[model samples]
Target: MTQTPVSKAPVFGAPPRPASDVSAAVGLAGLAGLMVWVAICRAWPEIGAALNLPGPRERLAGSSAAVLALVFSGTPMVLWSLLVDKVHLRPSTGIDWSAPRPLRAVTDGAMTKLAGLWATWGLIAFVYCLARWYWRGPYVFAMDLLEQAAPLLFLGAIPYVLWLDRVLVEPRDGAWHFGAMLIGREAYDREQVWHHLRAWSVKGFFCAFMISILPGGFGAVVEADWSRLGADPVAWSNAAISAMFMIDVQIAMVGYLLTMKPLDAQIRTANPFLAGWVAALICYPPFVLMGGGGVLDYHQNTAEWTYWLAGHPALLWLWGGIMVVLTGIYAWATVAFGLRFSNLTWRGVVTNGPYAWTRHPAYLSKNLFWWLATLPFLVTTHSLVDAVRNTVILGIVSGVYFWRAKTEERHLLAADPKYRAYHAWMGENGPVTRRLAALENALVGRRRGAGEGVVREGGAGEESGQGDRHPAQ
Candidate 1:
């Protein structure tokens, strides 16, 4: 019998599969800088304490700390980019530098590098300013929101900016190659990689923020005693629902981070419509913070029938169940998207899970939940005009979501051929689409029956005329 040949294992130091070296090196450098900064802060308690103190002295100390952080972070990246460009990058081969790259390119790369280093300190300064003013000002409660949100945003922005900067400027001449081997496919074009990185970096920040806030919810749930549950079921139910919402948020964050396998490069989105963008912006922060002048605020739409029904146990359960189901569906859509889930850009064509049923399952379910929760139809109003106005506003919000769905499809169809195929399949196979087709068919059949009767009557008249002309014939 012939002996089976054993395959040789890859050598330990073999250039890392020639994946996106630039991305890898940049990432490593960023981490190194952060580690160094953290170590310095740990070793020197005076610097940390000075930075945290209140007022002008603290601000000056923070600025000095930020400069040090930049120095610590920026050095590794500059050196690595230099080493790779000079040593690893060759004239004849892999990435596209025919001649030696100028020193200017490397210096330009440092701008974003500096920006990333300063992101955390910048956030800290902003929060301090906001807290100092807002806490002492009329909106005293805003301070509480600040404390809960600031740390999440600050910590998240550090990595977000680091990746963001790496993508912002493409130094093809540098030792780091622009092309990245993603999802085990061909090397991604520099542009594609840039877009993918930008989208994810921003998306990651949002996900991180969501993940960070989860601990507050966990703490609340943990501290809650079950013995107190029966005393006020509505409050307990609300608390439980809130807890589940946080869990859904955590699932989404993890799914976004993990599902980027096989290179996560499935679909890329086309440019979205301006109206859709505007509508989406109004629903989120900064714009939402602007108060009534902002496009539309969900808080303005007070709850109606559902909140009232909370007093009754059976109705309350039904309402709570519906909300929970809707939340689960939203989360399910995110999970279905896996690593492809991002707003504004197309990541890939996701056709499984809730997507198989309807094209915009998350948006559909979410809007439905909102409508149910708000029940604009049953909302109390001072006047009939007010009632109509409230209903119209709610309708506009629904219309915005509908337009968002249409625009997303348009983007996906143009960008991903797979999405185009999926769109066709969904039209034919989706549950909602099938139901709409059946309804249309019924309407057409009834119209055809009515038309046939009219035709028969007209035919009799024509035959009588012909018989009159031909007598007995």
Candidate 2:
């Protein structure tokens, strides 16, 4: 039998395939994936439409992006794989150098991102207001108006910065790799993730404050707003937006567990907090970048904001509530499905908690959860504008994620051999079986042994843990 590289975290037992030879893999995968898609279209037009068929223009753009991405990323992965194959490169090869990630897209990423950390347009308005206030007791301006126009400016920055960073900086990154690569993130070590998480925690706090506090601060400062902060629709809307942002954070923290594999175990057992911090840190940087740009600017400036603002209370309030609830379910399933920690592969699920019943409660839960995530923004949105934005940002991204998951599922099914049986027992409803099994697991755990927890592993009277096997009769 062939042996795979021993990863720091336990995986669901991959067949020890070599890491993609970045360049060749991309060339192969892209050609293969496209050919497969073409055949699918020829064979199954219904499925093609179901995948949200893109227009000619969008298809061209996407295909170009995919090709460029394949080259940029595939080259590196291919190089690394060759290095491993030829030299047997060890995991310890990555430099441990600690450098600050300067927010400068072009500057060495080791420096702090001081210049572009805050939304420039909003900052200009804010700073201008502050300057006026210092000179004159207070000033008046439709600050929110400036915010409305900022999205276009912000969205434009992504491609530009990605280019600047990769071209000028020492780091060879992409959008997926901070933008240098159009696909897949290089896995970092446990310590690297921890430090990154610390950075993320600091930034997340600032972001939460920006979302929740900025509106209140602005409202209190405005002469009309000062008299009735709550009365102002924009102020109320801001509060709601901020609240939802935090709620989303909590949801994402748990939501990530759905995609986690077995290796996440080390995080759970060795250091959960650190693992969580890393996950949140990496996952949320995209939002932070958006925040720095005051992501909603484009919508606000172009009547889109006004339209959304006017309808936001109903749109966001109603749909946001539903999203929150579904997110809550996903969060619950995070633990219920044995999805928490480092899920490198399928082995993470076991006899414990939700695993006794359904195979992937979190999978379908996530399917619904992604839709819920979109609902909040949709509720506040009107027209095809909002629809298009959500389609690309949320829908497309989520769809890609699900597609990759199916691939991983296929790999797991092949690896475990018994996965089909387990899945059959669980049923396709996903959560239904897992929910019941989770309840039973809890009861069994409670009765079988005190608060120590239920028997998670397949072994009798023993909890399932990484590497723990089922007791032989």
Candidate 3:
């Protein structure tokens, strides 16, 4: 009797609805606002003098000014999301604005939530104090900024929490649960407390780094001599790349700072797995293992694309263009997140823009850019050993990123059914993901076939009494 073949259809439901939490127009609006502000800052020296403003004739390139740019960059997104997308009314916000509870009724829960939030901030501050890296180099700016904002944040939380609790469908959220655990006044879910800590940890860790690096790139782009770049391919490409980085950093910092439930941008869950944290933290400073002289440093004795392709004008132009495009894709990945971008957290499932083509476009483009731009295999020292070592080390670095992507998938797949559907859809339909899956399947088939052939040959030898065996047997 013949048996019927099982169906190979995906178990994951229909592809997630095309709707995304944040719209493309919302991000584009923020981009427009940021560009307008950047232009004004670049021309501020002249404009301030023209208006007889009380300041020196210099562009606003200070760290404080860059922080202000975060405001400019974020405000338009908030406005667009509210005015256009009406995200505040979304059911995901867990808000029922139609019938706000009496202030007295929610006052207790609000206080508990605030307690959890403040304690979390205090703990993060303690960690910052203990970490020596927070007080040195670029982190000094972050420290300074936080010091100034700490009081404001404490003062602001009271009203925000109180107001939010009145409309919250479930006021005893993760923060409230954490507060309950701390106060020992009410029953609380340990998992909720754990999730609360993880979310804040992601925000605290990434936000500081984002703020510390913000002013440098913003200043570079604001102070760039655009007139001189037109004739120099290297300068032109670098300028473009710098601008892209500025966009990414500025917009991403805003996302980290503004995870308000009212905006429908609250972190759903921080990546819960320890492996996820390990994979992510090692790529950032103070824990980065890929820095110069570090264990995973892959840039030792390497010559960059510009150096190797120096005399070839056409090739230099082509290579530079490729790098710039890759950098743009990386930036686009961040911008596509709108107000939902952050590391090791799920704000929402974004399925539009570059994300539609591939789930990990940013990681893919980033690793590719490093390979093409650094040319790690082509060492300046001209030693075969150095070349081989650099290439292998870089491969390991890429593997770390692959690890990160997988861990993120594990977290998201567990947290959201939408992500599961999107994952399955991408595996079956995404241009990049489908091709890569096919290649992987093909390789696995070849290996299995090769192993089976070897087993058959061994069996034949044993049957013919030619197989290796002990003489005693």
Candidate 4:
């Protein structure tokens, strides 16, 4: 009897991260950071008034600020969950669309997104406030920060809570049996549900979002132009930059929310997303840590933001064009390689999708999207230079990709002979690689048939109307 084999390439490009999953953890941490910033700023004046702030009180204040940050960043979910159960919401498998029973129901997810959004936007306002405070223009304490960010904080709540909860709520059993209406509940098969969970994983979103943050973060690094903050022209400019940053973050989040899923959640052998995230976590933090807002020393300012954004439009044109044209091609290739290969015991050589065009479509797209998304935040002349740098990095990463791809192919080939054949066919079709082949070809060209005396045919040395073989005409 013959055994039937399964191919996993049926779903290559994962679903976008649902808004809920992507934002929840990050928003929680961000909220904590912002709240701490707010509390410190708010309390500074009063604390200073009570005691000489330059003395022990200042140190105490800083310590308190750090502590507040830690708490706000870490524990809000625990509190929310504790109270959530106290409110007696059922362990649902679907959405409850009929007015969350009480405002508190709406408040949970809504407040979280709103708070997170506000905190981020508020950080933008803080730039101006910091500037004003430095210039001695009366933007003194934390209240100033709140006042500046208040509108955003309030308005932001609308999108965050409404959208995220909808994504997260599971119907008690795949059908929210509400009063005359079925809410975010639909029948779900285990396979589809698992697919969804995998699709919405953090790795899908983090790759793009992290890449772009440097520019925005850099914009936040400038010492507040205190005088300009209180003034009209600069104040508005600052606000605009803040708004832009907010838009970018959300854009990145949404992109992840909607596309790029993983194979599973357990970070085990079966999951592709965990691997993607693990790869991203390794590559991303170091670059970002050395970049704009992640640094302890300074954040990105308008100039920095302007500078970074300059590179994006061109990159978007180049890579976006490639992806658009290649994605369909990628689909065919993903399926073909997946099936013909007949097995996947290989190492991390992802030869599906656009990988057929080039060995490292994932690497290329990752950098392309990262730089493209980052361009809006920092519109600068250095965009090309930065691209060049990224290209260099790609060269290095390609080495790893090569090793991984090779290992994976070997594994597949070992498991199934058809995979080995397909691999060779692809190699024969000319994988336009940029590495050793070029130099080797060049070296070969300089020596091989250097002075061939072959007869010319057709237009070069023969009659214009003639075919190469006289009788063939």
In lDDT terms, which candidate is top? 3
What local lDDT does model 4 show for residue 389?
A: 49
The better-scoring model by lDDT among 2 and 3 is: 3
CA lDDT of each candidate?
0.45, 0.33, 0.80, 0.33
Q: Which regions in candidate 4 have their CA more than 4 angstroms from the true location? A: 1-33, 41-45, 51-64, 73-75, 85-274, 284-473
What does candidate 1's lDDT look like per residue over 363-424, in tens digits?
77777777777666554444556556667776777667666565555445445544554444
Candidate 2 per-residue lDDT, tens place, 109-215, comes to: 31122122233334344554554332322112223323553576466645544443443323431111222121223442444434333333342333322232223
The C-alpha stretches of model 2 lying farther than 4 A from their native spots are 1-317, 337-340, 350-393, 428-473
In model 2, which range of ten residues has the least summed lDDT?
A: 464-473
lDDT accuracy of residue 169 in candidate 3: 94
Q: What does each candidate score in C-alpha RMSD? A: 18.7, 23.7, 10.6, 21.4
TM-score-wise, the better of 1 and 4 is 1
**TM-score for all predictions?**
0.51, 0.29, 0.90, 0.27
Cα lDDT of model 4 by residue, 142-237, tens digit = 333335546774676476446535534431211112211212333335543343333323322242233234233323422234456443432434
Clashes found in each candidate (C-alpha, N, C closer than 3 A): 7, 46, 0, 48
Model 1, residue 327: C-alpha shift (Å): 1.7
